[model samples]
Structure formats: C-alpha cells, structure tokens
Target: MQSKTSSYLANLLQFCIDNKIHKARKILHAYLLRTNQFSNTFLVNRLIELYSKCGHPTSAHLLFDQLSARNIYTYHAVLDAYCKSNDIDNAYEVFAQMPERNSVTWNLIITALSHNGFEKKALENFYLMMMGGFVPTRFTLASVLSACGGVSDVGCGKECHGVAIKLGLEGNFFVGNALLGMYAKCGFVWEAIEIFKGLPEHNEVTFTAMMKGLMETDRIHEAFDMFKLMHRVGISIDSVSLSSVLGVCAKSSFEDFVVVNDNDRNWYNVHGKQIHGLVIKLGFERDLQLNNSLLDMYAKHGDMECAEMLFDNMSEVSVVSWNVMIGGFGQKYSKERALEYMEKMKNHGFEPNEVTYVNLLAACVKSEDVETGRQMFDDMSCPSLSSWNALLSGYSQNEHHKEAVMLFREMQFRNVQPDRTTFAIVLSSCAQMGLLDGGKQVHAALLKDVAYTDLYVASGLIGLYSKCSKIEMAKHVFDELPQYDVACWNSMIAGLSLNSLEAEAFIYFKQMLGKGMLPTEFSFATNAGTTNVSLGCQDQHCEYVKILFYNRYLAK
Candidate 1:
C-alpha cells in the first residue's frame, strides 16, 4: 500500500506534468517540505523537467542546485533546461562539469549546439563523443545529420547514411525523416527521393521537406507530381504543404490553356480553387497564414473577384490580408479602391507598412494621380529609401521630369540616403529633361556607391548619358559592367539608336548575338528605327536586316 505522503507527491508531479500546478505550486512546495519529499531524487528531477517545459528554466536550475546529492538524471534535466532557455554557454558549462557522460548527454549538447547555429562545433562534439566510446543513437544521428545538412556537406551526410545502414536505423521513422531533410537541403535531390521512397512511413513533415527541396532546385513539375501522389496516398495535408504547392502552381506556365482564352502567366486559379476547398473542408479557413496564401493565389491568378470575396468573408484578418487587397487593386489600376482599403486597414487598428505605401503609390502612378502620391509621401512618419524611390518612380513614370528632379533634391535634403532604385529613376528624369549638369552630378554620386553597378542602375546611367548626347560616357559605363545580361545589351543598343549611330548599333547587335543572348521583342523594337538612319545602314547590313525581320516575325 502507498503511503499518503507518497500518493500526494505522485499527484503533485502529475499536476506539474499536465501544466495545472501554477496556482497550487506554493501549497505543493509547502506539502513537499512537510513530507520530506525533497530528499527524493526522482521527485527533484521530475520537478526540474516540469519547470523547464513550463518555461521556468531559472526555477529548474535553482531546484537542481538545491539537491544535496544529484544523480545523472538531475544533471540531464538541468542541462536540458539551460538548452531550452537558449543559454548555450550555460548548458556547455553544466555539460563539462558532469562527472560521467552518456549517449543522451552527448546527443543533448550536439543538438543544442546545432540549434544555436554552431553546426561546426556540433560536428566536432559528435566526433569527440565517438572517440569517447559512446555509441550514437537514432537521436544522435538525427542531430549530426542536421549539422551536416546545415553546412551542405554531402560527403559527411553520405558517411552518416552509411552509419545509419550499419546501425539498422535506415527505416527508423525519425532517422529516415532527418536523412531525407539532410539530403534534400544539400541539393542531392535523387538521394533524397530514394530515402523518401524507402521510408516505412511518411508524415506531413516528410512530404513538405521533399516538396520544398524540389522547389528550391527548380524542379517544380516534379514537386507537383509528388504532391498529387501524397493526395492519392491519403496523407494529411497542412498549411505548409499547401503553401508550397500553391507557389509552384503560380509559377507554372499555361501553354495548354492559351487557346482557351487564358493568357495570364499564372493560370493556376483552377488548382487554387481545389486547394481552397480542401482548406475549408479541413476547417483551416481561419488560419491566418493559410488565408494569406489563398489570397495571393487568387490575386496572382487574375481572380480578384474571388480575392475580394475571401477578404470580405474573413472574420479574423491580419495586416497581410489588407496588403493583399491593396496590392491587387494596384495591379488592376483601381486607385480608389486601394485608397479606400488603406483607410479601412487603419480603422481596423493596423498601421500601414512600407508595402502598403508601395502599392498605394504604384496605383497612384498608374492613374496619374500625383497629388495623392505626394500626400501619401507626406503621410509617412519616417520615410525610408523605398518610399522616396516610390515617389520618384511615380514622377518619372508620369514624365514629370522637373518635379522628379525637385523631389530628388528634397530626398538629398532629408538625408534619406538614396539607394539603387533612386539613382535609376532620378537619372531617367534627368535624361528626359535634358538636364546634363544634374545628370553629371547624379553620375558622380553614383560612382561612390558600389551598388550602382547593379544591372538596372547601370543601364539607366548608360541610357541617360546617351540621351544627353554624351555617347562616350555611355560606353564608359557599359565597359564597367562585370557581366552583362539581355537587358544590359538592350540598353546599349537603345542608346546607339537614340544617338543615330546606326553603324555602332548594328556592330553592338552582332556582338550581343555572338554572346548567345536571345534578343527580346523590346530589343527589335529599339533597333527597328536604325534602318532609317543617315549612315546608309540599310545598304551596309541588308542581309542582317532580313534576318532581323525573320526573328521579329517569329517573336510576334
């Protein structure tokens, strides 16, 4: 028969495990003192574990210190408490002071180090643990595999897999899942697939890892195929898997639907509807992040009607929900609706973030509503570089070159520290207004910023110089690019055509083709005027002219 004191101690420990002892804690401590249960090592260790899980690591450590004769379990509980608190240094201190070490102790420290971004250190400890003759368990292998994956060390991961096979843990669910995640993240897609296939059981986490890995490596179609397989296998779908699938669907092309009057690049609206139904059936419609994904899918799929309906139906909405609506309206050039929602979002007690202002300003630009854009700019409590660039973009897009230059000066006065986009838009404004002196000042400032060599900014500088009739400077900027893309080549060609240097344009065109860059439609459009130049370009490049026409027709 159990004694009354022992029964009470058992009940107290159960209360702690169930997280129902917060108010009764003082009484329980008083009773423990009265019953002399503090002398029980098992009771003390259980209290430490309980307090740590309850987010009271300090209390757990105090309890551990109060023990007159601590056992291995007491030390393990305290170390775990410190690790849970993210106090890795303290955990290491406790770990080093342990008189005897076991496999569990090594695994705990290795996992804690890995979790805190010390993957190299975690690997070192794993090696040391083996040298000390402690055999690695499934938990130990999982942690080490994660460390290997963190550093993208495929060789180490493969060696770990060989060890798993020797230890007969290849099909162990937890170990198999960890190995799957390891190989997938390390870009060993085929090996990951094989592990995933050989798994004795599959979980939602397993599928999500495989899908994310496939998506990361640009194998989108295969990911979708795997997703369908999961559905066939009746594996439960969750928000993460749904989100990944929706993202891939958005990027997929719709060549098969082009003949059916579906021209949107993202024709995934069909698949989106099916997934939305699943979310609803699973009673996850109230999930904030899942709702956000559904909203983005609808907006990008060109189904604003569905997006607006979903927004209206949401009883519990977040700021991202409102941002999605604003962005969708901006996409449709509906400035009024976007502006209305800006107020609606504020009324709902959410302040507009940088993305809100970006969408609002973009809508204003499309509608040529410069006054609203200026108002929005003034409304920002602390305008960032993105805000200033947004206004500058609006001015440049509307051909308000003089106003844009004025805004640029104001940006300098406010010390906002213009970024790459700022230089691009401001240089464009200078080119339009033929402000050669201002363009030169902007160019001088750009020379000091290393980020200006980014493709867009460099291209804008080249075009600006050509428009100001400074072709030499344009070439100088062009020569400085470390690597050139199709847009970089197109900008150079456009500069030549603008300056009536048809001969130079054709020579650069040949150079671009020699670099194996397929010319875009914009490329042909810019060079279309070169044949009418005064250089007798038509007589000089008659054969190439015909080839251009053939390609242009194909582009059409």
Candidate 2:
C-alpha cells in the first residue's frame, strides 16, 4: 500500500509538471504533508521546479524552505527559482551556503548572471567555479564567452578560447559559435574568421556570426561573398542569416546601379531578392524582424514598390515597419503618400514615434512645405534633438533662412541645447538670410562650446562669412582651424570662388592638389563658376586652370 501511494503521488506530480497546474501541484503537496511523506527530498525538488516553471517562484521558495530533507537538488531548485524571480541577491546567498555544487550548479549561476546583465559578475563566478574544481560544460563556456564579448574583454575572450582549445571542445558547434560571436562582436575579425573556418560544419548561426563580424569590420564585399557561398552551398537559411544579408544589401545601395521599378537594383539587390524568395520558400514570411529588414533594405535601395507590398502584407507591423515605409515615401519625395501613410498608421491604432515625425519633417522639407513642417514640429510631445534638427534642416532646405534663425532662438529659449547639427544649419541660415549679427552670435556660441569644432562646423563658418561678404573674416576662420579636413578645404575653395576671389581660389585649388586632396563635384562646380572671374585674368593662369581640370578629371 505504501509503495502504491508513492507511485500515485509520483504520477500526480508528473501530471502537474506536464500540464503546469500550480494549484493541482499545491494540493498534491498538501496531500504529501498529510500522509507524512513530506520528507521526500526528490519529490519536493520536482515540485519546486514545476512551480518555478509555472511562474510561481514564491510558492517554489516556500516549498523549498519546508523541505525537511534538503539535498543539492533541492538547493538548485530554489536557486533557479530565486534567479528566475530576478532576486539575484537571495540566489547568491543560497549559492554561498551550498555545501556541494555540480557542473549544472556553476553553469546555472553563470547563465543567470549573464542573463541579468551582470556579465562582469558572471566572469568572476566562472573563475570561482574553475577554482572549485568543477569542469565547465558547453553551456558554461558559451555563457562565459558571451560575457567576455559583452564587455569587449578580448583578453578574457582569448583565455577562454585557449581553454576551449585545450579541452578539445573548440570544435563543438555551440562553443565554436560562441567563440565566433565573441570575436566578431569584440572587433577581432581575423580570430573570428579563423574560428569560422575551423568549424567542421556550418549552421545558420555560424554564418550569421561570421557575416556580422565581417560587416562590423567594414569588409562589406567579402561579407556578401560569404553570404552568396552560404546560399549556393544549400545550407539552411533562417531569419537571422536573412536579416544579415539584408543589412549588407542596405549598405550597398550606391547610385550607379540599374533601377528595377521604383527600387534601384544594385548588385546586392539580386542577392537580396534571392534571399527573399528563400525566406518565402522556407515559410518564414511571418517573421517580423526579417520582413522589417527587407522593407528597410528595399526602401534604402530606392525600391519602395517592394517595401509597400511587404508592409501591407506583414501580419505583424511594428512602429519600425511604419517608420521605414514612411521614410521610403519621403526619400522619393512623395509627401502626400507619406502623410497618407501617417494617417493610416494612426487609424491602425499606432501612434507616431519620433522617427515617424522625423521622416515626415524630412518629406515636408523636400516638398518645400515649411508651414507643414513647423506644424508637425510643434505637435511633437517630446522634441528630441533630432526633431529640432529636422525642422532646422527643413528651414534651411526651403530657403526659409529667417525662420530657421527664429526657430534656433526658440530652441535656445526652450533650453533644447543645440548640438553640432544645430549650429551648422542655423549658421548657414544666418549666412543665407544675410544676417551678419546673427552669424556672429552663432560663431560665438561655437566658440563657447568646443563640441561644435568638427569639420562641418568649420565649413559652415567659412560659408557664413563668404556669403556675408566678409572675405577677410572667412580667411581668419579658415586660418584658425587646427585641422584641414576635405570639407574644410572644399568650403574654403567654394567660399573664395563664390565671393569673386578667383586668384585666391585658384591658389587654394593648386595647394589642395599639392596636398593630394582630390576635389569633389562641389569643388569643381564652384571653381567652374569662378571661371567667369578667371576670364579677365592672364592667359597663363587660364591655361593652367584648364590643365588642372583636364589632369584631375574632377567630374562630368
């Protein structure tokens, strides 16, 4: 009869474990107590694990404390319960009191620490686990390597890699993938590549790790090649690999390629289309992240037709999806379509996020609709710097120079603390409006904060003075700059040419050539305009100018 009762209780616990019925589990626990069977340590541990899995960590903890015959299993149950509860302090306290721990115990702590964003502590516990003479399992190695990657602790990562090699576990798929991810995320591209090659086999995750690492290092073309090889080898492609491929596609959206419909089908888009077909064939059409990446890639590549179709068909639409779609319309200068999408987004019960409004402001700027842009800017509940900058950019784009300066003052009044972009836009606005005093004030602000001393700001200052007919002031600003980046030189030449200082502009142009600074399209265009001034100069200077153009072959 006693054996039958124990078996019955075991069956009952199994049912609760399978069905996740915490109430039924509690009732069984009460029956065990009434039958004087509460001394069963194994049964209590199972109950605790069940309760924890059912999201009743408190009940699990209570059952753990009531166990009369506690063992390592019982303690592990409670530790997991505490960790799952995010009560890490209590979990560590229980760990400190445990008289014995197995590999699972150490792995649990490390994983729990890493999951809770205590990666540094996870590493320390890993060291302590090793000192305790516990052999690290595959899970432990993965967690430790992940922690190392999180903090970019390449030294620790290398040591972990060495340990994996010595243990002959470096070839293990999970371990190999972890090491690959670690090296990739830490900017150790070569090591990551080596591990990737050493993997006896490849999986979706392995490809993702390698490709992500390559993209991170800016070896974009090589990354695409790997992606192509993966697809051609008939290796299974999942959402992750597809997203990585899409990221590469987005980056490869240059202007030279052929246009397919509304989208420019660059070299990457061919692969992108193949990956898209593969995604559909694999029945992953419902994957939100992958589809979102596709939408963004298409939008960036000038393929709004594909983006719109994908957006309309996605079963799950996030704010990101809507934003990307709107941004696509904005990119194509379709302000009406963008606004219509904005309304539809609202009708679908999604509120406009910061990105949505930023794109709309951009569309307004593109259409030269400053009034609409201002209205949208005013409607923003929380105006981030991007929002402010968007409107400021709109003002500058539409030749609303006075309004741009006025909005800059409004930004200052509201304590919206201008950033580098703000100064660049507003200074240009002041220059265009011919507001000398306003330009001087903006310059003073740049002087007050060294944060605005970047190349764009230097370019803006030079442009401002030249447009204001203060050639000497522009020269002073140019001479005072400690660095001469491409933009700075371009701005100097452009300013000199536009201000009818042809001789000075030509001297700078020659000096730029001597410095090996290749002229941009703007450089040639501005200098070409100065040819009218050069027309009145000596024949020798005019002939030399033609030689410069012919030799540089600057632009069409």
Candidate 3:
C-alpha cells in the first residue's frame, strides 16, 4: 500500500513540475507533511525541483535548508533553483558546501556562471574540474566553449576544441553547434564554415549562427545566401533567422554594388520586400521583433513610404518601431518630420530613449541647428557615448570647430571617456582650425586607449598632421595602420599631394592600383586638383599627373 501511494505521489509531483502548478504543488507539500511522508529524501528532492521549476526560488531554498537527509540530487535540485533565478552567488555557496559532486554538479555551476556573465570564472572552474580528475561530459565542454566565445578567448576555445576531438565527442550535435558558434563569434568565419559543413545535419540554430557570423564580418551577400540556402534546404526558418536576413539586406543596400536590371532598380530593396512577403506567408507577421526588423530594413534603405505603411500595419508596435521611424526620417534629413514623429510618439505614450535622442541630434546636424541640438542634449539625464558623439559630430560638421574643441575639453573634465568616433571628430576639428598641439594631445589620449590603429581615427590623425604641414608625421600614422582600406590610401595620397609631393602621390596611386584597390572619383580629383594648382609650372611631374588623371577617367 505504501509503495502504491508513493508511486501515485511521484506521478502527481511530475505533473506539477511539467505544468508548473505552483498552487497545487504547495498543497502536495502540505499533504506530505500531514501524512508524515515529508522525510522521504526522493520525494523532498522532487518537491524542491517543482518549486524551482515554478520560479519559487525562496521556497525551494527554504525546503532545501530544512532537509537533513540531503543527497547529491537534492543539492543539484536546489542549485538549479538558484541558477534559474539568476542567484549565482547562492548557487556557488551550495556548490562549495557539497560533500561530493558529480559531473552534473560541475556542469550546473559552470553553465550557471557562464550564462550569468561570469565567463572567466566559468573557465577557471572547468580547469578545476579537470584537475579534480573528472572527465568532462559533452555538456561540460559546450558550457566552457560558450564561455570562451563570451570572453573572445579563442586560444582557450581552440584548446577546448582539441579536448572535444580527443574525447571523440566533437561530432555530438550539441558540441558541434557550440563549436560552430564559438568559432563564428571569435571572427573566424572560415573556421565556422568548416565546422558547419562537417555537421551531418543542419538546423535553424546552426544556420543562424553562420549567417550572423557572416554579417558581423561584413559578408552581407554571403549572409543572405546562407538564409536562402536555409529556406531551400527545407529547414524551418524561425523569426530570429528571418530578422538576421533582414539586417543583412539593410546593410547590403548600402554596398556599392549596382543591384539593378536594365531599368536600374535596386535589387537589394526588392529582396528586402520579398523577405517581408515571406514573413507574412509563413504566418510570422504577428511576431513583433520580426516586424521591427522589417521596418528597420525599409527605413535604412530610405523608403519612408514602405516603412510608414508597415508601421501602421503592425498590430503591436514597440518603442523600437518608433525609434526606427525617427531614425529613418533623420537619415533623409527631414528634421521637421522627425520632430513631428517625436510628438506623435509622446502622444502614443512612448518616451524618447538614448537612440532616439542621437537620431534627433543627427537631424539637427543636417540643418546646422546647433542651438536646438544643444538644448535637446542638455535635457538628457545621462547621455551615452553615442549621444556625445552625435552632438560633437554636429559641431564639427557645422564648422563650429572652436566650440567643438571646448566640448571635448568639457567631456574630458567630466572624465567621460571618448571612443573612436569622438577622437575622430575632435581631430577633424583640430585639423580644420590648425590646432596642431590639440591634435597631438588627442593623439596621445588615443594611444593610451590603444585605438591608434583604428582606420577612422588614423585617417583623422593623417589629415591633422598633413594640414599642419607635418608630412612625416602623417606618413608615420599611415604606416602604423595594421591594414589599409581604400579610404586610408586615399587620405595618404591626398596628404602627399597637399604637401606638393606629386611624384610620391603618383607612386602611391600606382601601388593602390597594383593592389587591386579601385580609386574613387575623390581620389582622382584630390591628386589632380592639388597637382593642377601647380599646372602653370609645366613641370614633367605636372604633365605626368594630368595625363594620368585623364587616362584613368577616359579608361573608365
């Protein structure tokens, strides 16, 4: 009779766990106490698990504390309760007090730590687990790999990958996906691709990771292709994957590729609309985030009509929806429209956030409305780095160079750290005003932050040095760049030409061409324009530059 009763109670507890019936679970706990069955270790563990699963962390912990006949499973149940509630500190306490721990115990704490942003500590625990002579399970390796990716510790990730291979668990489904994600997050897209291809089966998650990896690395076309392949392969494309594809489309619209037919229509825009159509067909139109992505993609492409139409059709609009509209109009330099939308957003009960303010400031920049921009910026309670950059950029763009330098000093006085954008904008202002000393100070700060190699910041330094007639300093900045983009090369060419080094400018241009870097019209114009100023001299180098410019333009 007792055996049958215990079996029935076990079934009832499982049902409570599965359906998360907290109230009913409480009644069962009371009945167990009334019937003197509360002392049963297995039943108590199940009760603890039920409370944890129901998100009653305090109740779970209280019951765990009262249980004197605790086993490993009991400890595991309570630890999971804390982990699920994001009470990692308490979870660690329980882990430390455990008399014995198995592979599952180690995995629980490691996963808890990793998910709660204690990634480095999680890796340390993994090593400790190894030193304790416990062979890691697939789940253990997956958690450690996730931590590696979190911290961008690719060296440790590689070591974990080797362990996976040694344990012959690399082919396990969970481990394989984790490996792919780690490689992708670490910016090794090719390595991710190799792992992706080797996987025996593809799922939505696997494909999504690969697409995001491609997107992050600026491989927009390839990311979109992966989305298409996911659809073609008959994998169920979730809202996340669809949203990611829309982001790729938004970025691709800005690429220099001529997405056109004979009529010169943008195929990228057409592709974005097609994705929207697919979202509707798949019955995912009600997914709020996916719709937001659709709206954002349309906005980024400057199709305000489509964006507004989609916005009106969205049944459940979020703050992101309004932010996208404001930013969209801002991009088109429609300051009045952007302000009007802000009013409408307030009427609809959405308060402006940092991104909204940044977009508003950008609109103000378009009209050189620095006074109004200043008023809006002052209203922000705690401005973010982006907010600072927006107003600083506005000041620089509107030729408020002196005021811009003043703002930079004020920002420093407040101990507000400047990022690459802030440094670049301030440097541009210093260059325009010929404040070589101020530029050098900004350069010193940039070096302290180890951001001297950034392409945008480096270009600003080059411009400042060149404008100050420090051609050698400009050349040194260019040489220090880890890799040269076309913009950097153009900056170098223009700096040389500005200093009347026409011969050297021509040589760099030739080298640019040799490296297969296509020169834009600005590149040709800068070199030709600077050289043309000396055209009256009739020097051989002047003749060579003129001939070179005409030949290049004519060749195109």
Candidate 4:
C-alpha cells in the first residue's frame, strides 16, 4: 500500500542518484500539479538533503523555504548542510532558530566549534549540554577530549576523564584512546603510562599512545621497551610506531652509551647501519620525517657519507631534511656545501626557519666570513631574537668587539631586546677587548632588563671584570649571586690566574672544594704552578687526583 506521494518521492530520489537533475525537477513539478499533498514536510526535507549533497546548497535552501512547518530533523538537516558547505555562521543561525534542541543538535554545534579552532567555545557548549540534562555519548566525550587536548587544558581534560569514568564509558575503545592521547599530549606522561598499564585490554592505539607519551617526556629507553613489549604481544605496528622509534634513534647519542672495544672503532657504525636496514625493511624510506631521522642518526654516528647518500635518495625533501643536511655540513666545517644546500632549500620553495639561519650563521662564524654573515643578517625580513644573537656572536667571535657593541646598540634602537645568550656573548666580547665602561653599562642594562639573574650571565660578568683588570668588581658580582656552580668558581679561579694572583686562585680553589664543588680542567690548570704541594696532597688528595685524571681522560 504505497501512497502516490511516496511513489513520486522514490522516483525523484532514483532520478537524482542517476545524475538526472532536470528529469527529477520535472517529475516533482508534475507531482505538485497532480497532488496538493506533494509538498509534505518529509518530502521537502528529503529533496533539500539530496540537493545539498549534490553540491547545490542554493537549491536546497529554496526547497527548505517551501516547507510549511519545520521539525527538529529538518533544522538539523539544514544545519548539517550549512556545515558541509563550510558556512558555519548560517549553521549557527539555523541552530538558533530551533525551538527545541536535542543531543544530536548539540554535538553538531560542538564539532563545528572545534573544527573552527574555537576550542574554548566547544567546551562551553559541552557544559551547556550537560546543564540541559543531556547525557553525553561516546562521540560527545571524544570530540570534547580532542578539543581539550588541542588547547592543552589539563584541568578540563581531567574533568572529562572523571565524567567518562562516572558514565561507565571508560572502557569504550574510542573514548579510552582519546583519553590516552589527551594525557600524553598534555605532558601528563606518567598518568598516561599508568592508564596504559591499567587498561583491561591493549590495542594498537593503546601501545602508540604509551610510546608517544614516553617519547615526549624524553624517556627514550622506556619508549623502546614499550615498543619491544608491543612486538612480544604480537600487536601490529603502524606508521606511528615506526615514526616514534625512528625519532628515538635519531636523538639518542649512541656514542655516549655504546662502549667500544679497543680493537673496534667501527662498533657504533655497525649498530647504526643495522638500524638503517631496519628502516628500509619497514618501508619508511619515503616518509620525510623518518628519512630525516635516519639521516640525523647516521650523521651523529660519524657516517656523513652515508647520510649524504640518504639525503640524495629522498624522493621529497622537507625543510627539516634541508636543515639536517645543512647542519651536518656545518658540524663538519664544510661551509661551501652547507651554503649550497641552503640555496637548494630556497629554490625548492622551502622557506628557512630559525634553525636553518642559526646553522648558517654558525658556519659563517666558523669560516670567518663576517661580511657574508652581516649580509645574511641584513637580508632577513623578520629576524628572530636567536638570529640577532647569532649575528652578534659571530662579530664577537671574529674579534670585531666594536662591531658587536654597535650591533647591540642598533638592536636596542630597533626595539629588539637582547636575551640571556646575547648578554653572555657581549660580556665575553667586553672581556676580550678589556672594555670596562662597556661592561659596566651592559651590567646595568642587564639588571634593569632581566627579572631573574641567571648563573651563566653572572659568570660571564665576573669573567669580563677579571679580564678588564677589575678584580674588585668581579668579586662584587660573584658575591651578589645567590647560587654558585662549579662553572662560577672556575671563572673566578681563571680570572685570578690571568691576573698573576696564583695564591688567590689557589685559595679560591680550596674554598670551592670546601663548598663541595668539584674542580675542572681550568681550575686544575690555574693552580698548576702554585707553591702549595703540601696543600694539594692533604687528606684524601690522592682520590681527588684520580677524579681529576678520570675527568680529563673522558674530556679528551
């Protein structure tokens, strides 16, 4: 017992699906002539959704206008249409006109807000839905959790976790995964790990979350163990797992951990080459991030030739890859090759970021290409603070003390305030040039600008005063410092030795040891010719010599 209106609607739907738009419109017009009941609300809503899906929102709006009475579903349909077309404002308008709203209505609005980067607003809507007595489903919680994670709103994320637990939705696979992702991304690595360990069952998503969390916290060993556990449990690894492990391999300093036998200088190289094979077997060679990670791993292990080979074979090089190759060349002191890669990066339509410029500046500084460095600095369209510091450091390192001072003043004139590194470099320059007046001026400006005194800055200031032959001023800065590390004491000792005050240097060295501070090479070297053999060999002094020897050997 199919009604004539239903039959006509079915035929229209079939015509719409078959790309017969004109035929469908003619059929609908004939139906309207034959039956007064053809303009039913359900029929109209169907036509609107069909037209909107067919990429004709204007026609959908026209069909929606012909409806005599709009139900909640009709409004929802139109709102969805507006959202699909990326006309969020019109969707909001349709939502506002709804006389009554349901959970579906609220979910749509929340998702729209999240997509538009209105994370705060999306969370607010979630709260409103709760106040309206609508119990959120798993989809609702997932969307809200994602929004909270986007803004790193740890407080709201915890609240959502509590709500999910109370609603007995914690075991829902999607909800659990989202919660883990939120905790991991928000720096709650310990909490994320606890959640993973306590999970009733583990999935691939669970393992990925735990691995990502551990990696984010710099617990590379723990992350690798988790990956191994995943393999033992027979869980399939995906792109994310491979990417995370590659990142760990890239950042881990293998030389520091791998103890090579006396006969084998190539031990670390062998291990790194094995890892490179694993990367190929996993078929991640085409992944830009993973490829760059492999390149970095090989470069760090002193296999620059293999690193270069990998770089040449990359099908698509990103800005990160370019930076890695450039930095590798810079580390090897190959200025010409580094500059050529930098030009290639630009020619490939990849704009250089702060890191790229920093490496280039370091290369220029090492090559003593002060003129070229200055040109690069001047050509920057929007120089970051790090960029300014690099240029100033280059000038200082090249013994252009006056030029460094000039650049500092020019930075101030341009309203670019100097950071801690800038002060450190400039103070070191003042020390080299014996510019007491400039040092004092910088000290005053530092106190005025820096809210908290850094130990490094204080040490630099002390070294500057001592080199300028102002030992009293050096003592004043040192005495005012609230905390003193070994470096601080080393600076003072070196300063005393430079002034030919060997006795004072030895005395300070004894005081540093009394404060439980260890002596460094500079400290030992400063007291090398002191007239205090008996003092040096006092109680447990043999142990001190052993420690010094060990540290010196390791340093070499």
- TM-scores of all predicted structures: 0.69, 0.67, 0.85, 0.63
Q: How many backbone clashes does candidate 3 have?
A: 0
Query: How many Å off is the CA of 350 in candidate 2?
Result: 3.4
lDDT by residue for model 1 over 363-393, one digit each (tens)?
Answer: 8877889889889889888877877887888
Best by lDDT: 3
Give per-residue CA lDDT, model 2, range 160-259, as digits (tens): 8989988999999999999999999899999998999899999888898888888888788888888888888888877888899888878764632223
Native-referenced Cα lDDT, model 1: 0.83
Clashing pairs in 3: none
Q: Residue-pair clashes per candidate, as listed?
A: 0, 2, 0, 0
Note the Cα lDDT for every prediction shown. Answer: 0.83, 0.85, 0.88, 0.78
Ranking by lDDT: 3, 2, 1, 4
RMSD of 2: 6.8
lDDT of 4 by residue, 312-371 (tens): 898988888888888888777778988999998999899989889878877787788878
Candidate 2: lDDT of 262? 46
Please say which candidate is ahead in lDDT: 1 or 4: 1
Candidate 4 Cα misplacement greater than 4 A, ranges: 1-136, 143-152, 255-275, 299-302, 345-359, 365-371, 384-386, 389-556
